[model samples]
Target: MKDRAVLYTFESVHQAIKGEDVLRAAGIACEMIPVPREISLSCGQGLRLAAADAEKSEAAWRQAAVSWQKKVHACRVDGRYRYGVEN
Candidate 1:
């Protein structure tokens, strides 16, 4: 198995859902994950993808003209969470 990465975050669930549809339409592999507690304890969701595919996913979202407030972050799923730049 391989580690995964988070692609983007939206201010509301509706935006996240719409973004998910756009990413899927663009042929990007993505799923909705609970927003990390570090960011918010609320039930907000975000899009996840394979770390290797993060860049492509971001580009696809941009090309689709989706509006998102936060940038993507690279995350490793080990016991320890590591954060990196969007790329």
Candidate 2:
């Protein structure tokens, strides 16, 4: 499979920060980033992590009661990013 990354968009800044905390607490590496233009226009905050960590990140957030508004798949090519499927 192609190397993939995950993008998580939040409904608010608080949720984004909470999500990052949850992931980090669970030992999953993630970073806060700008929500992609294709995702939404409202919240500008999101989280980025390797696709390998997606499942663990999801579990961490749910277990910690951290809510995210959307999850998107990102394709990384030649160190550049292109939008992928949104869930």
Candidate 3:
């Protein structure tokens, strides 16, 4: 719970919107953000959630069948974000 962020990039805007609603209904806090530059060049939406809630969010997504393309874990370092890995 170190303020780390978990980013979930979806294949489509509909999926991203659906994902946000699903997570919210599951009691997982999440935000919809522009897909990160490194993740995709095309304009797209992503769901950002607390890293501490990653597991819960993942389960919720799976149960809801909310499709997503990627899940990346990022940490704040020196006031900048550093994406460490993907899953």
Candidate 4:
């Protein structure tokens, strides 16, 4: 199996939920994932998006004018992990 993930953080939980809604409306598959411990040990909500859809997801967020802070990291779960471009 192969999987990709992206983390999108917001200043507040409200913004995070709102952003999720916008992305869902745009037909982008996303889920609320725990903020990676490496990025921030603090417990907060973030978004997990498929790596294959990363580009389209970012584009949708921009088009929706959703205020968010995002970090795009690509990793291969089945094989060796790696980081990719940040959008």
Candidate 5:
């Protein structure tokens, strides 16, 4: 879906880095970005990925035993997307 994005949140920057490492090992491309305001009120890092990869990405993390805070899925609405948490 166009304009769709997925952000995997962690408890802290360090946890985000650890999750990033495991995802990289699994060959799933992602970026470390600040937690989107749509997702959190506090400053922290998040692993961002294509919306298409959200589910598989979370699965990959779980399979690797990498803990994550939450997954936010964004979908285009009114030419923009809003983030909402997913388990």
Candidate 6:
């Protein structure tokens, strides 16, 4: 949804997949999407998450099956996803 605030950028697609698995198992609502060009063209995928669950998501990611680059608190400003490092 447009209100969702953060996108967790993984180091790699594999890591993003692992993150998806972990969040699913932990009951966090999220998905693996192509890493938006706005975030980073270098990465292939990212995990979109609800802004409200950010704190819990952080814990979930810590227990993820793999690692991520770090999460970004993304806000769609002027129709673009503007972001900042969340760690």
> Which candidate ranks first by lDDT, i.e. highest?
3
What digit string (tens of lDDT, one per residue) describes model 4 on residues 1-87?
555666677666777788799888888888887676666666777887777777787787778776677575756656743445342
Q: Candidate 6's C-alpha lDDT?
A: 0.76
In what order do the candidates fall by lDDT, top score first? 3, 2, 5, 6, 4, 1
- What's the CA error at residue 65 for candidate 4, in Å? 2.1
> In candidate 5, what are the lDDT values of residues 1-87, reduced to their tens digit?
456778878987888888899889888888898887767888999887878777787888788777898877766567765677332
Candidate that beats the other on lDDT, 5 or 6, i.e. the better one: 5
Q: Point out the higher-scoring one by TM-score: 2 or 5.
A: 2
Write the residue-wise lDDT of candidate 1 on 20-82 in tens digits. Answer: 898788777788887777666667887767777767766776787666766556656555434
Q: lDDT of each structure?
A: 0.70, 0.82, 0.83, 0.71, 0.79, 0.76
- Tens digits of lDDT, candidate 3, 23-68: 8888888889897788788799988887889888888888999888
lDDT of 6 at 29: 91
Model 3, residue 52: C-alpha shift (Å): 1.3
Clashes of 2: 0
Ranking by TM-score: 2, 3, 5, 6, 4, 1
Task: List model 6 lDDT by residue over 1-87, tens digit each.
Answer: 456477878777888888888888889898677876766878588888878887787787776546678567876656766677342
Colliding pairs, model 4: none
Better-scoring candidate (TM-score), 2 or 6: 2
Model 2: per-residue Cα lDDT over 53-80, one tens digit each:
9998888888888888777888777787
Best by TM-score: 2
Task: List the candidate 5 regions with Cα displacement exceeding 4 Å.
Answer: 75-82, 85-87
Model 2, residue pairs in steric clash: none
